[model samples]
Each structure stands twice: as structure tokens, then as C-alpha cells.
Target: MSDNLEDLKNNHQDFSKGSLDSNEEKNPYVLFGRWFDEAIASGELEVNACVISTVSVDLQPSARIVYLKEMVDNSFVFYTNYSSQKGKEIAINPKASMLFFWPKNERQVRIEGEVVKLPEAISDAYFESRPLQSKLGAWASHQSDELVDSSEIHNRMAYYSDKFGDVVPRPAHWGGYALMPQCIEFWQGRPSRLHDRIVFTSFEGTWKIHRKNP
Candidate 1:
């Protein structure tokens, strides 16, 4: 046990990949776009993935990874089953936090904001673009529910496949939600633990920018 603890404590890496100056950029969304492009150029997997945290009615926090589908009107959008655990939490709380970590680039972005369902037309268009199998699977799986066995899901999948053929419609329970960020903070890793931090806070349609100590 002592050896394992010592090994864990010694496993450290110094970061010097990038730096961010709060004075250089006033728009968090613009900086986020550049960082996202660089991450894609670096050839990392799942660049759009982010961790979403939601609070239950009882104040318990739950977090899971979801893909960032789109950003429009200053809101980040993602799709999922409305019956999922996170969806239920959103129903009661109507707010969430999203974290994006690009380890290869030694950068992370934290966003906190209110969540609202996307317009039905947008969800319909996106759903129509999805592959036939994905549309079928969305109908087949009851998200966040206990499964009796693998066969149970497989049976459901087969049933949906036979029922929908090649033209599966989007289920009413599955759609997109947009997170309107009230605060966005960008972190760029630096050497000697002196990381750079810049935060943008929204107020009455204006953004107040500031820096934080590392």
C-alpha cells in the first residue's frame, strides 16, 4: 500500500504547451473556437466530447460525458433521451455545467449555465440526418433503466428494426437541449503550475471579463 501511494504521488507531468492572456481576448466564444480547431488539428479522438454535470432534485450531482453537437445563439447544444437521468435532473433544475478537457493540449474549458430544450424543428432536422440504425437504437434503449440482460436490449433493437425498416422517426422522448452559458472560464496549462485562467461572466447581455490566480 505504501509503495502504491508513493508511486501515485510521484506520477507528475509539467505543462508548457500554451498560454492565454485575458487581455488579448474579450470573447470567450472566440477563444473556444480557436482552441477547438487546434485540438482537432492535433488529431485527438472525440474532440467534441465534454462532461455534463446536472443536479438532482435532492441536490445530488451527477456527471457524464456527452458530445457537443452545435453552438448557436451563444448556447451549446447536445442531444439525448429526454427520459435519461440527466434529462430528469434538467427538468427540475434547468441548469448544468459542462467541462471540456483536452489532455494532449493541456487545456480545459468550464462552462456553467441554464439548460433549455431546443426548438422542435431543429431537433427534427438533426434527427432526420442521423443514420437509420442510430434512430432505431434510440427507440430501442430505455436509457438509465436497469436491463435484465444483453438479450433484452438486443430483442428491443430487433423489434425496432423490423418495425421501422429504413425510415425510423425520432421518438418524442429523444431530442436536443441547449445550455446558455452564464459563465465561461478557459484554463491553459503552464510550467511550474502557474496556469493561466481567464473567465467571462455574462450580465444583461454584456460580458465582464477577468483573470484568476492559478
Candidate 2:
């Protein structure tokens, strides 16, 4: 290593939290649930947060952080404005990917799949569960759109608050999207930079598992 980067290059951590065995859970969802539970129990902040990537029709890629709300029908679920940049991109190209990293445990998961809109009833139910202010925000924010000033959002929030009074309805432009994953990969960090990687892919309604070099 160069002398200028010698100290930085020498800094490393020995990841000995856990290991991935071939005999472990075969279903990716099962494995994900186990790891997610452990993350929560370990006091990881924002454990449900993940980065989602989308590509527009022009082939430009964009990524943003979103919270994973639930796992339903073998898919990962999250909510957002249907008119947002990511939503528009997904409309043109349904293919998307999600990534979850837990630095404390030195683990990561990658999910790739096509996204689909959830039914209106499901969105309604989840919306009702949100706090009052958040419900108001859903109606106030014209997500991904240009705003003249921050005060515009406050004005809209005030308008919606007075209009809805106590019961705020979910906006027609807001709902949930489900990512039906075709491939899922799990990675575990280890000492000496020799990491463990396992990938599961879907084929003919069945999932096939494979180990990957890392």
C-alpha cells in the first residue's frame, strides 16, 4: 500500500457474527425473515429501510431509500406516490431492484424483480394505520414535482387538514407497490475478505439455490 493510504488500508474488521451454510433455509423469504428478525433484535436503526433502484425509458437509472412495509404473496411491499419519479419509471419499465445492508452484522441482501401496484383496498387499510400528520402529508405532497417554496407544502397541508377534519382519505395517486422477485441473493462478510454468497433464482414455479464466489 502507498504510504499516503497505509493507515486506511490497514484498518479492517474480522466479521465473525455468523456463517451461511448450504443446509440453511432453502426459501429466500424464510432466510430474509430470519435475518430481519435478528436485525431488529440487535437494535439496528431503521431495520426496514432499503434502497430501490429504477430505470427510466431513456435508460437512466435512479435510486432512493424506501421502507419495506411488509412481505405479502411472496413479494416485498412498499408505498409511495403513484406519480413520483420512481413510480413513472416503474410504469414504463417494471423491472426494479432492492438492496438491504446491515453494516453492524456485515450482511446484505439483493432482490431483483418486476413491480406491480397493489389493490386499492390494501392501500386503504395501510393508509388508515398511519399517523394523522403522515396521512395529511400523503395528501399534501405532490411528490417528485417542482415546488415554488417550502411554504407551498405547508399551505397544502393546512388545506387538507381543514378539509378532512379527522378522517383523512388516501389519495388516488398514493398506494403500495409489490416487487415480485425473480432472484434473491444473500451475502455474509467474513475475515480475510473471503465472503459467503448464496443466490436463489426462480424457474418453473420452483426456486433453485446456488453458491457464488465472492
Candidate 3:
């Protein structure tokens, strides 16, 4: 392939697709829902995809993509193995952030919050709704654990399949997490590399909305 690094280094695209209205609805949740709906309408793939960032006890930060499953009482809910890297990090430090980007709309959302594990009942309900393979995989994979061989996981999967038969239950090590937002920032791309950012901060059980310099 030809060298494109130099070309890529100089390429730039001006963003002018949208701008956040200062007088728009101040409730972040309401605004998020509206933006999410618009993303869906605009045919953005994986509209519910979000990046979850967590920090280990050593202050090392890690980010991974997770699908937003639901919202519970204003918390963003997502599921994963409790033994995974992110899970363990959250256990050490509950402080986390989530990022939702919709390049198609020239918009992104940054959410800062503390995460808590969802109740087992909620996790069970979601697990029951998953496809059979997913439920089985949840039991087979020892998340975040070092594996000497790839085949070991498949072997474990086969064993779980044979053992559980047609009814696989959610593993005890897997569950849901709810991120309760303390600060939410909505960003809209504008021309001249200047963007619009609206921030909603929760204080004393109420949201304080304001604008931030881009």
C-alpha cells in the first residue's frame, strides 16, 4: 500500500453539522433521550454503543466499548462480567465516566459518575432475555483471566453447554452496573473548530445547567 500517513497528518475536516442551543431543555436526561432518538433516526449504527472508562487503584485508566442496555432511575445500565478488568477497577474506584459519540451528527456526550452494581434480580432478568449462546458464553469465559490456550475457552463452553443443556443461568460473576451521573456534558461540533458544550451538574438533588468553553 502507498504511504498515506503524511496525507492523513495534514487532512482536516471542519465540523458544521449541528450546534447546541443555549436555551434548549436543561434536563440532561431529556436532552440525552432526544439526541439518542435523533441518532437512531439518522441511521447511526450501534447508537447505544458507549465507551466506559475506569481507573485502577494505581491511577491507570482503561477504556472499553460497551452497549448501553437500559436506564434505571436516571442511571445508565450496562452488563459485563464482574471479574473483568473494568469490573475490578470499578470495585477499587467507583468513579468512572462514559462517552457516547455520534460522528454522523457531529455530537458526543461525556458523563462523569459513580458506578454501582445492579441488583441480582435485574441481572437475572436481563440474562434470561439473552440468546442461548450468550448465556452459555457468560459461564464459559473467565473474564480478564489469563488463558494459556484459546481452545480452553471453547472447551469450557462445550462443557457448560453439555452441563446446562437448554437452560443456562447467569453466572454469579456476571451482572449489571448502573452509572449515576454527577456531571453530563453535551457537545455539538461547529465551524472553525469551535464547538458548543453544555454541562449539567447535579448538586443537592438538582441539576445546575451551564455552558462551557470549547
All-Cα superposition RMSD per candidate: 1.6, 2.8, 1.2
The digit string of per-residue lDDT tens for model 2 on 33-144 reads: 9999888888889999999999999999999999999787989999999999999999999999999998878899999999999989999999999999999999999999
Please give each candidate's TM-score.
Answer: 0.95, 0.93, 0.97
TM-score of model number 3: 0.97
Please write out the lDDT profile of model 1 over residues 117-209, one tens digit for every residue: 999999999999998889988998899989879898889999999988998988999999999999999999999999999999998888999
* Candidate 1 Cα misplacement greater than 4 A, ranges: 1-6
Give the TM-score (vs. native) of candidate 2: 0.93
On lDDT, the candidate that comes out on top is: 3
lDDT (0 to 1) per candidate: 0.93, 0.93, 0.94
Please give, for residues 98-157, the per-residue lDDT of candidate 3 as tens digits.
999998999999999999999999999999999999999999889889999999999999
Per-residue error for 204 in candidate 2, Å, reads: 0.8
Ranking 2 against 3 by lDDT, winner: 3
The CA root-mean-square deviation of candidate 1, after full C-alpha superposition on the true structure, stands at 1.6
